[model samples]
Target: MGGEHSPHVPERVPSDDDPADDLPDGLLVADRDGRVVVFNSAARRMTGIAASAALGRDFRDVLPLHDAEGRDWWKCLSPYEGLTIRTRHPERSLFLADGHELLVTAGYRRDAEGRVERFSVCLRDAAHRARQERDRADLVSTVAHELRSPLTSVKGFTATLLAKWTRFNDDQKRVMLETVNADADRVTRLITELLDVSRIEAGRLEMHRQVVDLAGEARKVIAGRVAAGDPEDRFRFEARGELPEMWLDPDKVDQILGNLVENAVRHGAGTVTIVVEPDAHKEGAAVTVRDEGEGIPPEAAQRVFRQFWRGPGGNRRGGTGLGLYIVKGLVEAHGGAITVRRGPEGGAEFRFTVPAGAPDYAS
Candidate 1:
């Protein structure tokens, strides 16, 4: 279930640019008399019968949908003999004679006299919905699983401190308080990641753009690590070629840099190096984060960016396994791409490119 699911071919909404034949979802339209009028290519694919074969024929003869109980759907819902007020049959799984399943929804177009004029049915594969449902379930399970530890720590420490405030010495209290603080931060981060995932999945991630200094953001990341007790000598930064000035979300750039650098410092070894340069192959500039440690395997390079992925040594350290995934989403949201490879110094190297020089729509 962790692996990718079957392709989700979304049905196209009928528009001037999107014709019925071009729809990714199956569709069938019939006259009030049940004569097939429109059978799109998707329907052809699902039924393995050409539009020409189905057109002008009775739709019952074409689709011949049956329920799990072997009851004929056409016989069950005689749209022609139904009440004039009948509008639609909501989407549900219905099978063909050969046992191929299709998600089918039927609508009854009504005339001014409240009689059915056209019977329209939208068809889709069930795999897409099944995958979506599984994803939602996974997210819910992950939230519950990930939040319990930190929440318990925060609650336990806070409760113990409140109850035994006078019993613990200053040093002991400080440690407990620090532990609570760290757990609180972890909870906050988990919540933020959940929100980000929600927004990313819903395609509602907002981009507020301004003139950003990409290289400068990298410097800030390095400086932040140094200030947080990391040795300055353990880090290196380089800028190559021309750096372009363009509109971008500076905070998102900072986030991407921070996550990659943090991952390097925590999971990788030796000195971490960051480079910024013009991407000759892409319109945007490029940034690379490399570490002088054992590099990732060739096979895992692609899987590193997916959800719930962790490095070989990941369990020893703590992470939600979402940072790289979020970083990928953020970079792609900026019209950018990210990839990982073996570093020249024998460690993991992550490089990403964002489309530069395009004016943000808000501008």
Candidate 2:
């Protein structure tokens, strides 16, 4: 019987001039009979339904709510006060009559008799939030899949070595031990990337800014890579002109160069080159890392810096694809810009600049 009654059943209701109308959050109040009584300005803007059309309309009929899966969500509402639901459900979505979607949460108010006198629903545009959630889930799933392979290898090798310790020769044991260690290192690198991502997202990436010898730092990175047996002949370091000491974070510089060089050696074909030169336009110096591998396509140059953005051939090289993204962030944090273009050798060349003077890090 209550569902059949018209929305005008409530004789006294709050007018449009009520303070609730000025609230930022959308507020839709329905009477005990489930009729819309307080359709505020914010609610009208959120649902695109005028107060004149919604005020006397049944709440269920006027607010065509739906879940993320497009199932009717109005059924979740209850008329009794004690039976009301109030909480922010991130997975819930509200579908407007015009096909727009909104994220919604609901609450209810009760009279002295303990009966549900009014219901309120708050609404927000869900496009951005929903996209963020979906991206986060994708990242988690990708990272899990990446972690599983090395874990399997580590487990399998260690188990085999333990069981066959007495049966295998010293050389065989050493080879298996090296394989296990490589897998462990792979796992560690993935975990470190994950932590770096977390820090970047939280805006807590620490940068210790001081005058750094750019040429010296680049040489050290190249030396480290060579020492690690990453094709010593494949890497070449060159300085175009006299480079000066710049105010930069040395550790960040190492990370940037290391990621770029490692990426080059892993994906590029013949050679990887690191060049440092004085920036004519700015007082700082510019560094370029080039690889003779398959250069990035024109369309992919911009997207290469995005998190987890791997090209079509990315599968060939086992990488987390977070290197460029971290490099971009660290470079920008030092008040610099980075760009990618076709190298003179017909390969991918990544060029970034470091400011001569330190940026206002306090901000």
Task: Please estimate how well model 2 matches the true structure, expressed as its whole-model Cα lDDT.
Answer: 0.79
Clashing pairs in 1: none
* Alpha-carbon RMSD to native, per candidate: 7.1, 7.9
Give each model's whole-structure lDDT. Answer: 0.85, 0.79
lDDT digits (tens) for residues 123-234 of candidate 1: 9877777887897798788878889998999899999989989999999999998998998899999889878877887788899888788888899999999999999999
Q: Which ten-residue region of model 2 has the weakest summed lDDT?
A: 81-90
lDDT of 2 by residue, 1-363 (tens): 135656438533558478987787677777778877787787888777887777766788878876666667776544453343442334356787667888787766776656777777777667767788898999989999888998999899889988878999999988988998998998899889889888877888887877788888889988898788876788888988876667787888899988988777776777889999998888889999998878889999989998898844776777888999898888887778999988888788999997787445422
Q: lDDT of candidate 1 vs native? A: 0.85
Per-model TM-score versus the true fold: 0.84, 0.68
